[model samples]
Target: MSDSLLQLSAIDIATGSNPLYTVLWMHGLGADGNDFVPVVQTLDLPATPIRFLFPHAPLQPVTINGGHTMRAWYDIQHTDFIKQEDKAGLYRSQRAIVALIEHENQRGIPSSHIILAGFSQGAAMALHVGLRHPDKLAGIMVLSGYLPLVHEIRQEAHVANQLTPIFMAHGSYDPVVPVKLARSSLQLLRDYHYSVDWHEYPMAHAVCDQELIDISRWLKNILKEALISDHQNR
Candidate 1:
């Protein structure tokens, strides 16, 4: 529960022995680390050698919600369906993410063995920071996510994540972050020569069962890849 760097509280979960993988999950606006706890357990990933790090977002004034103070990674411009944007908040959040990455590295988790993921606003930050950082992480999972900094990212994305596998899922009927946004973002990433795995669900602004299943399978695949790479290195 330290405010060092990102003001994040981190926990490590080990299954058998040494940690096999580290999955860092960030929650949506107004949500806390507990938001994804259900998904973590529902997936029954406790048996896997994965270290789940769910970081809490710092409380902030959300423009989209009448400036209510909530656990937000950043701020939105407004609640108007058309004027909602969060670039300023995202910039701050990315700095926190970079600091969080350094902290994770200090904890003995190699970037090659880490997975960056998020939901909603958190997902937007995930896409921003996960792709631009100088190091290559194992993977990036964006669930029910929208790309907030597409223009800046188009100008700023580094070559490192061009090959880093990204698994993103969104819901078609989502009124919050429209599915069109996600699809267009996927196209943008592809246009940028990024390796991305994209999928669409039938729900609205949320994680559905099928998406969860897809995420679980995708996680297992990346974990397998991590193990293969680790073994090859040894």
Candidate 2:
């Protein structure tokens, strides 16, 4: 990992040895990389080792939280996300994430073998950056968050990931990031004919056991497909 690109330290976990694919997961606002560390063991994945990279978001003052400094990808100006988005912050984080992807590429893992996963604010960043990423990715997993920069995504989305599989899981009783926002993002993706696997659980702004099971299945399916593609290309 590049210290300049990723200012904060990250927690690295591998299911086993000889990892073939990487999942770069980001945490929700105010949380560090360790936020989702425990989930690694909970998901029932295949026997093959999978690398999970959880990077800590940079510390910055969040407007919605009374301008108190916290670890967030970007600042949330108000409750209405469509208005007054923190574009500068979002783009800054986007570049940093791209650099992280490049770092993974240098480690013998191609862009197509990488997955972007995140929660809440981090999920927003994943949807924002993964779609606009220059190269194709294995998949994107969004948990309990809405897509940021809704007006700009349509114009800025890259053609490389036009058909990339997206797994969006939201909570029906989410108080932080409303389920309605997630559904609206889903509707937009569907409108553009994007392949999105949407799931909703009757819970709050948090991950559930059933969601973890579903995520494990999704990871296995996508990673298996990526491995096949890798073999065919070689």
- Spell out the clash pairs found in candidate 2: none
> Lowest-scoring 10 consecutive residues by lDDT in candidate 1?
1-10
lDDT per residue for candidate 2 within 1-234, as digits (tens), equals: 223644546788988887878999999999999999999988888888788999999988899999999898988998987679999888889888888888889988889999999999999989999999989999999999888888888899999999899999999999899898899999999998899999999999999999999999999899889988889999
Q: Quick one: best lDDT, which candidate?
A: 2
Q: Scored by Cα lDDT, where does model 1 land?
A: 0.79
Residue pairs with backbone overlap in model 1: 174-205
- Per-residue C-alpha lDDT of model 1 across residues 31-106, encoded as one tens digit per residue: 8887886677666453656777788888777776887889988777754322556666677778877787877788
Model 1 CA RMSD to the hidden true structure, in angstroms = 2.7
